[model samples]
Structures are given as C-alpha cells and as structure tokens.
Target: MPTGRALEDARSMLLETGRRILAAEGTGGLTSRSVTDRAGVAKGVLHRHFADFDAYLAALVTDDAARIRSIEPRSAGSTVDAVTDVVEQVFTPTTRALVALVISRDEVRRRVRSPGSYGIPLLMDATAVVMDVLAAGREVGWIRRDADVAALALALIGSAHLLYAGELGAFPDHSATHEVVESILVGSL
Candidate 1:
C-alpha cells in the first residue's frame, strides 16, 4: 500500500522486481502477480502505471536499452579489455531473459522496437555500444583501419549472447569473456 508519490513512482520498483524475477527464474517465472508480490505492492499498482503486462515489459526493455547505451567502456587497458568489459556488462542473466522475452512475445517486441531500428532491443543497443568502442579503437590505432566495425560489432555481440544465453548455472568467467573477445578481435586488431 504505497501512498501518492510512492504509488506514482512504483513503476521503477515494479520494473526492478520484474528484472529480479527474470534473472532468478527466467521469463517463465515473471508475471504481473510475481512483480507486484515481490515489490510489496498491489497488483492494481502495476496496471495503474502501465497499460498492461506487455506495456510494462516494453518499458523495462526501453529502460534497459538506455542503460546499455550509457555504459562507458573501461579505458584502463587494451581495446580488447574495454570491449570485454562492455560485453560482460551487457550479457547479464537479466538481459538475456529480456532478450528471450522480446523474442517470445510479439506485442512486447513491437512496442519496444524503435522506428527503423533492427535486431533485439537490449542486444541492439549493446551492439551499438560495442561498435562505438571498436570505432574508438580504430581511431587510436588499436583496431584495423579497414575493419568493418558494424559487422565486427554484430559478430561480437551475437557470439557473446550465444555464449551467455546458453548457461544454466554460473556465467562464463572474466577470462572466458576475455578469450571470446580476443578471439574475435585477433585478426581485426
């Protein structure tokens, strides 16, 4: 039973709770009731904020996309290290579940799909960030000047998604993540 402002701001709470459910049990465990129950709010609070469950999911995807775009690549090491850091940030269990959810639900996909944008919501943004990092690498003489950054970005992000999405227990360690990134960039860098 949240009061006025708390009720108004319950959207973030609901979204965070949904993210937790998604990370803990995957998309199959996330529902309006689960979100409300986890947030300690009434179910009506969710509906009051979002038009429906799909709408709520769309908002979650959009919020996550913005978050993905805001991640600054680590500048402490090689471009490989920086890209690896970005990939690790992007491929969390929650994001993987959101990707699965976007793929599974047509309405949620349509709602979150940006006009003229391509690929899955969170992954698309992740690719863009990786591309930015690669582009910066090119400018700094790390990546090859002739490298096709868009294709490289797509390959890196897609391959990392495959590696992370299939994991049922512990996520791949940082060394594994670094290896994947290095393998991909070995020729291009």
Candidate 2:
C-alpha cells in the first residue's frame, strides 16, 4: 500500500492532468490515457485514484469547484476594475470549468451520483452564495431591488452557460445580461 504522501502525490498529478486537459482542450479531451499522458504517471495510478473516467472527472470537478468557491462573496463594485476583479477572481478557471460541467447532463449526473464533494449540497451552496451577492447588490442600491432573485439567478447561470456554448459563444450579450440583472434589482428596490 502506498503511503499517504504517495497517494497525495498521485492524486495531485491526476488533478493537474485533468485541469490541463479541460483548460487547453475541453471535456472531450479528458480520458485516462490523456490524463496519464499529461500527468506523466502510469495508467495504474489513475485507476488507483479513480474508478474510471466518470469517477475521475467527478472528483476533478468537485475539487476545482471547491477551490473556486473559496472566493468570498462581496458587494460587486461598479467600476470596471472592481467588476473585473470579481469576475476574474471569483469566477476563477475552476469555477468556469465547474459551471461547464454543471450544464452538461453527463457531467452533472456523474457529479450528483458520485461519492465526492461535488454533491447537491455543494451545488446549492454555491448557488446560494451567488444569490446572496445579487441580493446584496440590490439591497445596496447597485441593482434593481424588485428583481426576482430566483429568476435572476437562473438567468445569470443561463448566461454563463450560453457564454461557453460552442456556436453562440461570440455574441456580446453579457453586458446586456448584466444590465438586465442590475435593472431588475434597481427597479425592484
């Protein structure tokens, strides 16, 4: 049996591989062979750490999601710099990757069923943080107060999904979406 340190090393390598594959390519590039190749580890290493690609991906998604969730919720500043900071910092690469996985039927199902950190509670927790951010923004008079929090959250998630979609990825619609969200919140307030 490998020592704890050895196991951690292997897991780290696998995670690195997963992140690289997903970032440079996309979900399609994630495979045992690809991960092992990228990680420079033996195929057995992956099998030891994960049941299969589905299992490995689920764990990866969870690990990365957790890291991203570390970004604390705060009032979004209106300045371009402030908004950019939240976007780039809070929505870190891992968060984007996790969101990509969430919108995918296959990935989300695997994550839900998998025995890992990316469970329903985790998803809901992340959603709650986002909802809170929106609510706080509205309460502070930065967003329209009357905005339907639930629907706004849904719209935000949808916009994130649509932004990452293949064909329609090029539509400069986030500004519009943001405006709508802010408008709704401000209007409600």
Candidate 3:
C-alpha cells in the first residue's frame, strides 16, 4: 500500500491530470486509462481513490464549483455588473465542459443534487447571488418592488446553465447569455 502522503500526492496528480484533459478535450477525454496514463500512475490508482469514474467526475466538479463559489462579490459595482461578472466567469469553456458532463450523466446528476453532495450546487449559489442583487436593487428603486425575485433568479440561472452547457449544440454564446441575463434582471442593457 502507498504511504498516506504518497497516496495524497498521487490523488492530487490524478485530479490535475483529469482537469487538464477535461479542459482541453471535454468530458469525452476523461477515462481511467487516459487519466492514469497521463498521471503515470497504475491503472487501479484512480479506482482506489474513487469508487468509479462518476465519483471522480463528481470530485472534479466539486473542486470547480467551490472555486466559483469562493469568488467574493465585488465591493464596488452595480449589482447587475457583479452578477454579470460571475456569470461570465462561470460560463468559460472549462466550466461549460464540466456542466455538460454533469448534466448528461444520471449518476453524476443524482450525486450533485443530493444534500451534502459532492458537486458545488452551482445553481443554488447563482440564485442566491441574483436574489441579493434583487434586494439591493429594490432598496435603491432600481428593481420594481413587486418583482418576483426568486422566480426571475431561477429562470436566469436555469436558462444560462442550459445555454452554457450547450446540451444541443444550438445554444447562444456566453456574451449573448450574459446580455440576456442582464436584460432580464435589470430590464435594459
């Protein structure tokens, strides 16, 4: 058996290798053989650390989501701008690939939606940010008092997720998605 520290290092290397493959080639590029080959580890190493490929994928998504969630809201800016900035960051090619992977896999999706789940619950965080923006906007009379913030926020996130994930290869570009989200939230460019 590998020493504890050695095992940890190997796991880290495997994750980093998986991330590089996912970023460059999307989910299709990730597999036990490919990851172990790239990481120069035994074929069983990934399985030893994670029960299966879906588990590994969930771990990767969790890492990515945590990074997204850790971004502190900008101290100075329109709430719309703050939200837009986050949306732009979250819709990068890397993020899109991860989202697409998660959405397409039933087991992974189940893992993501479970309470205390591994993946980062990105939609929830996005919704929270939108709600915060809506509250601030309401305080400043920027948003109408009667706007259904929760519904609008959910709609924005859901639509953007689908667009960014490119489930059907017909989705709008990130810039267009950003514009649509901003327009929906603030009612103008």
Candidate 3 per-residue C-alpha lDDT over 28-49 given as tens digits, one digit per residue, 9 for 90 to 100? 8888899998887788888988
Instruction: Encode model 2's per-residue lDDT on 11-85: one tens digit a residue.
Output: 877888788777666666667899987777678888888877678777776675566456553434652222223
Cα lDDT of model 1 by residue, 1-189, tens digit: 846345656878899899889889988899999999899988889998999999999998888888899998765378899999999988878888899999999999999897898788888899999999999999999989999999999999998998897754469899998999999999998
The lDDT per prediction is 0.89, 0.57, 0.71
Candidate 1 C-alpha RMSD relative to the actual structure:
2.2
RMSD of each: 2.2, 5.3, 4.3
Between prediction 2 and prediction 3, the one with superior TM-score is 3
How many clashing pairs per prediction, in order?
0, 11, 0
* Over 4 Å off, model 1: 1-8
Q: How many backbone clashes does candidate 1 have?
A: 0
Which candidate has the top score in TM-score?
A: 1
CA displacement after TM-score superposition, residue 34 of candidate 2 (Å)? 0.6
Cα-based lDDT at residue 127, candidate 1: 92
Estimate the TM-score of every prediction. Answer: 0.93, 0.67, 0.76
